[model samples]
Target chain A: MMETTTSLSFTEDGFEAFAAGREEPQWLSDLRNAAWKKFSELPWPARNDEEWIRTDIRQFKLDRYSLALEPLTSEATATALMRDGVELGGGCTSFDGRKVDSFLKDKWAEKGVVFGSFGDVIRSHGDLIQPYLLRRAVNPNYDKFAALHTAFMTGGTILYIPRGIVVDEPFHALSTLSNGSADFGHTLVILEDGAEATMLSETASEDVDGGGLHCGAIELVLNPGAHLRYVNLQNWGSNVWHFAHQKAVVDRDASLQWTIAAMGAKVAKVNQHVGLIGEGANCQVNGVMFTEGKQHLSYHTLQHHEAPNCRSDFLYKAGLQDKSRTVWRGMIKVDPIAQRTDGYQRNDNLLLSAAARADSIPGLEIEADDVRCTHGSTSGRVDDELIFYAQCRGYTRKEAIQMIVTGFFQKVFDRISIESVREALGLAIARRVREYE
Target chain B: MIDTLVIRDLHVSVEGKPILRGVTLTMNRGETHAMMGPNGSGKSTLGLAIMGHPNYEVTEGSIELNGEDLVEMSPDQRARAGMFLAFQRPIAIPGVKLADFLRHATTNVRRPDRKEGEELIPMRDFRKELKGNMEQLQMDVEFARRYVNDGFSGGEMKRAEILQLAMLQPKFAILDETDSGLDADAVRLASESIAEIGREKMGLLIITHHDKLLVHNPPEFTHVMLGGRLVETGGIELANELHSEGYDRIRKAYPEADAQNQAMLEKEDAQPVG
Candidate 1:
């Protein structure tokens, strides 16, 4: 494979070159320029920051990775776990921030549904996507990573469902990263009133031990009475540095079920938020994480009830082995006007080794008198008696532990309606379980 | 050829404390033996030791299954070698369905050489056999869908154990107070189920304090265990005698073992319960 690095160094000159390469609308270019200015002005997150307290990034140097402007002529190798044995309404694959292959069924496309590469869709349907692009769900100036992603974001996926069109088949999007490369991919999904769809988006590296950088964002916009089931799997090699900003906004009577699973990355810091913007909006969030070696993953989540009569449920479960550590901080915030709001959040961690550690912090802030909000967190090791009982039933010691770990995550898996997602996650986790005495 | 499990002067301990000083027993396939003892007499300790419970350390003697020493093997290996123990207080495994657990277990026990991740028993055949056994035990079809032992009442737990005993079909099976905490009807159902499962097919070791469990499956040999040792061995009449009169006569006849049993009971009382 040839190693061709672009002269894009995340500087002013590089940003200008990147924007010039794409003949996008002047409005989009203006958004990128403004974001680039913010990216250059904002400082890197300090260790004392609340979200970065447990996530150390001193070892992460942006200079070690460079943006790849040209797509690799040779095919990059990566596994797509969520695409097994399912016909799709649309599918897109990107490598090193460039579109490699993408296809959308004509039936859905003819029905006023737009799905394709982000770069292509933004050009063709600029007027349709301008209002929701970094304008509503996600704030590009939230942090340094968010600003950088908006400024240099390249090949990703965009899905738009017109009013009252419900797509039965799921849309698939996969982003593959090569060793020592950087991926600034952005995913945007827009659902109009009464529109419904399911989107499965995942990230993978060419090698399990490869190194890369992924600073991305996901914005999900659900209009009135719209429903969306979004599944995101982050399986980027063990040596990647991942930082992401993901959020979803639900309008009146709309509902969202989002499942996020992360099993890779040397160090990952993610901020996930959900906003109930209109009355009677409901959202359910399920998070599953498995880490090993010296990996560290920290997730800060917020369930914000901005409107009255909204409901939100969040559950996150993580399994850690070796010297890996996971930090989960969740909050449920209900505004004063959000009367009759119902919010629930829980985090559970299962430690598989003596050295492994998990920090769970669950908080609730309710200003509404007629609302109910509850949160709970737990961290414990696998019980020896459970292993012994399974062993007595003819499972090997390692197999028993694996089964118990799988059982530990079964609660979240049960909440997932996708069968292939469950099986793929189960097998992936089982393969990583090592025999511990 | 007949299978045999012979325990010769076995000694076991828990957390550096000796529980079973010296216990010896022998049983061939198609035989039933009743072991009657009071609490802390090391009855359950013996059952756990035979199945290689990690906490039960064997300090002396040997447990042989068909001329093979089991002390060196893991619990799963002992299970694969045709041995089963129905725990008195079975632990709950949440999120693992009973049917799935048994399917993996049955596949491994039947194919002793099977490795982890190997194909389990076919769902069709396994479900059919499980349905038959569950019906014989008078269990509801929904019981198979529940998590293993999770939130089960005492009677339900005992019935689940019997269902496992019926499915595994081990060569030597130990029933560790399997009838305790059960009402009269539940005990009778459990006793009849055990008899139907093990009567001419497997060797049975029934550990209990009451006669309800021994009603349908009369023991061919009755042994009195005091202070971790068998003081006397008799026939079915002995089990009836103990049930009717209690252990007053045996305690008086065996004063030394009785004293040791009292001391162990006091020590047990001082410790916190799990």
Candidate 2:
């Protein structure tokens, strides 16, 4: 089956056999081939690159990583500890790039809400999925990793809320990877005019020793008058190297509330961009990351206001302990047509140990004269006064520091409207904080 | 016998400059002592040093709690050993819910004898006791929802401090200038709460620069501090003496303390930040 190579590297014949064995559609094969061509042409991120300045990913040796290449082979275990779908709502669990379990409430299904496996949706709603697959959001050629993900994309999930349909239920998806395996998954969400829903997606590496790869992409589109709340929780284990490219486009009068929690992975680099493309559109993007013990995490975010009267806000907060380090680069861009646009972006970092380090770079690019745009970044140590107060209450220094760090992230956590996701993410953050202790 | 906190000839410093020097004092269980002086007389330093603030170095002397040396104990260790300090300026921790903070604190301090690293008090008991204490302090039940001192008024911060004292129920509490920023009503409430906590159950070290807060709950010992020295020890009448005469006579008598004040004013008159 040519499932592997001598050096655990990817080769042309192996990839062709891998794709053809899966019987992927011809167009998908062509798309993947083109993506691979682009990936081969581009260069690895350089030290002088503006976005790559604070983060150096030279240690990521892609050739050494191996893909499972087989879908649920014998003895394959679904290692993901699945979270329950909210009562009456529905969720799907994916094991090593294949859908495992999926369910949706009857009422929402009755309302024409399409929640299905990525492949199933592509075949069933082919017309609706074709045009916006990777064209409207998450451009494949944006970077080296984006093209790599597109070239090797295996499995994914899609949520489509039909026009005028208001889905009160949440649709969740979890992608799990086994040790010595790689998963290239994609997520796509489309809300037509006046459609509203929440999409919560999470990824984790199954507990095992050998290193793995969790590379993926996300595409979200909100039609005029549509409102969507999207959340992405990334908590791959210490041996996993995670990379993702996520982008969203909000139309006129539409709103997108996007929250991301990055708390795991040995090293992770992600690019998240949101575009307020229509007048009166609004978007709020938030991120929380807790890293410890030599973990290196980086996030590059862009909030683009392309139309007049659009509003955008982005806040990224991180807490680093032990020898962990984090880099956050957030940019807000206002177009010339975006008159009276309101844009704000901030990145805050708290260092829990002297060995921990954080770099926050907030930038604003305003091409419009009448726009109100601002950006700020701050990195500071924990306040001793706060710790002393907590100590006087009998809490150990660790607990006091944990309380302060939790408070720092709680501001972002509470904005996550989904109770289960909020709680699960909070627990994940707490667990990460306790990892050092 | 309950517990006692004895501070003997204590010397303290911040950033290599001395703040409190050769200050000796003691208060056994069921006793209230007020240490009063003008601003920058190191009254707060004494409270902080007793609480073992890391930066407030105890350069000399010993602080013993029930015969155990507190000078070497971490603040949390001292707290677990039944010490409390109501900061004149309580720090605001945004997003840390009041209920959660109170619960952890109540559990830790209340169960000092619990094995190290043991689970905290049950959430049920913690919530019930917190409700009762908040009610007693006239704190809004919603105070449980808000962050600790985050966006709270000056008076609310003061009340929150007392709330900790009442719930943690420490055997020794030092109120560092507890009456500085309170309104008349809040000051009255704070004094009443302190009085209710009482000297018999706990030793109280009230550090203040004014006698207004002392009126409601008079101290058994009123010690005047000048230039970080314990200059006088008398009844509450000494408070009245200073309240009327102000620090003029005392400042005149303690020329060295007055010289320290002059240097501070001159420093301020120069470039403050520089």
Candidate 3:
């Protein structure tokens, strides 16, 4: 077994060299330049910043890793990586800045849905990809990672659902990194009005034998009355550092639901922002994170109500066992004119061991006094009575606690409208809980 | 006769105020005992203390089941030791199916060898057993799939407890005001369940204030409790006497019993025990 060291760095030479070698669009090259400037100008998040108070990132050194321009094509390595995604019940496509693995095109392209490398989308469907790619749905000014992802993103997925088209099953795009590798994968989803689809973006590592870095971004746009369900299941094995920015813009009467399940990664930072931009727009954001074995998971969620009569609800639950730690900070902001806005935010956590810890910071900033706004945060252990009740029946203490925790997380699972995604999340959560126990 | 439950000089309290003081009772296998008392006479407290509820503290006493100490065990341990209590007010636990809970309790109390062998009840056998018990108690079959006592009416909750008693089949059972808050039909069904348990060689201790339950299943030993103490012990005829005269006669026959009762009353009024 090889020892891995996960690290990230900022260097203009590496960015420019990769861009020049790929012969990317000149406009994208300019965007990367602006992002690099922003990444350098912005200061590190401080303890006074309300969202970053409970999370300590002083130990995260970004100067230890260089950009990985090469792809791992070994048959054994690709075979091992594809096996991890097989359990998720979908065909997988793997990308390295140069070429895509054939498994994706041979199995996924026949469905009339585009599942390919970002470069392929630019080369084949430049007309369809021009207007919708990086259209500011995910602003690069939110945080340093957002800026970093925009500056160096190289490989990703481009999914375009034709009008009134429906995909009966899910297709997976798995982005992984090898030893001393750096990855920047971008996933762009555009669902025309009346289009229905389910897309899953899973990021993981082939193995944790050496240090690697994964910085990715996902942008989703749903037109009027379009329905889209996006699930990001990120379990980048240990000895990997991950940072991601995901944003979605929903139009009139359109519904977009985002479910994020985070299990691995030595240190993971995520920012998810959803904008309900039209009347009658509905958005639900549900996330479940399990942190164990000294893992650190930091999640920041924003429910921005920009349109009147729009509805948004966010529920984030985390379970911490072993000596792991997690921080969940969420804000529901109702703009001044966003009247009749219905929004709710709740963060509940279960600390299974004394050494494990969770911090929940839920807040509300409502400029409209007449709207309904509420936020709640709670962190505690499993209910003793519930546990005792289960134990008295025949289950051992471990089995009883596991069942209760699984049920505790079932509320989030209940919100999943897709049966396959719901089942996959349930099995994954159960497996993580058992591993921690 | 092998004693199934022996409670001697039991002094139980909640939050430093005594509820059951110097009360002694014993029930052997194949017998049933009825405890009749007025409100706040520590009847329910005695039942809860014997079952090892965490809220009720036994200040001084000993409860033994088949020569094994009961006070030293937890509520579940006591339950696993062949002792069961049908709560006057059952707590509702959501997301836990009634059938699942019953199967757990039954398998937990079974002998180790029986549990290890193929005799262990399968899911189908468990469902059939649950269905039979529900039918015997006149309960809806769908109730078995619902959460444990969640959103159940008062009558339905009591009947559910009896359903548990029928399925778990503990050696010694305590019915704490099981007949309270029930309609006539539900009362009759509950009493029938109690009588059926008594007929199965399972010792029973019934606590009640009215004679409605006694009308259906007559008790062998009738004890009248006043002020946390047993003032008199008689045959089933005592129930008839109390039914006719109300508890005032017991208060008149023992004047010091009344003052002692008053003291107990003031003690209870000062700090009420649940």
The DockQ leader among the candidates is 1
User: Residue B41 in candidate 3 has what lDDT?
Assistant: 76
Reference-based lDDT, residue A230, model 1: 96
Error of 2 at A200 (Å): 1.7
Interface RMSD after interface superposition, each candidate: 0.7, 1.3, 3.8
Q: Would candidate 3 be rated incorrect, acceptable, medium or high by CAPRI criteria?
A: incorrect
Scored by CA lDDT, what does every candidate get?
Answer: 0.91, 0.81, 0.74
**Global lDDT of model 1:** 0.91
Candidate number of the best lDDT: 1
- Regions of candidate 2 where Cα sits further than 4 Å from its true position: A1-9, A74-85, A104-111, A123-127, A208-210, A434-437, B16-18, B114-139, B183-185, B199-201, B245-274
Q: Give model 1's share of reference contacts.
A: 0.68
- For model 2, state the Cα shift of residue A154 in Å: 0.4
- In candidate 3 the C-alpha lDDT for residue A252 amounts to 85
Cα-based RMSD of candidate 3: 5.1
Best by TM-score: 1
TM-score of 2: 0.90
Model 2 chain B weakest 10-residue run by lDDT: B265-274
Instruction: Give the per-residue lDDT of model 3 (tens digit) for A1-437.
Output: 12222112367765556566666666767777888899889888787787677666677777766664444445324222213333332344553333455234433345455656777777777677777776748887778887888887777777777676666566567666666566778889888777777777776666743456777888998888888888887767776777888889988899988888887788787888898888888998889888778888988888999888999989998888888889888889888888999999999888887788887778788898769988898888766555544434434455566666766686788787767666776666666664222
Question: Considering summed lDDT, which 10 consecutive residues are worst modelled in model 3 chain A?
Answer: A1-10
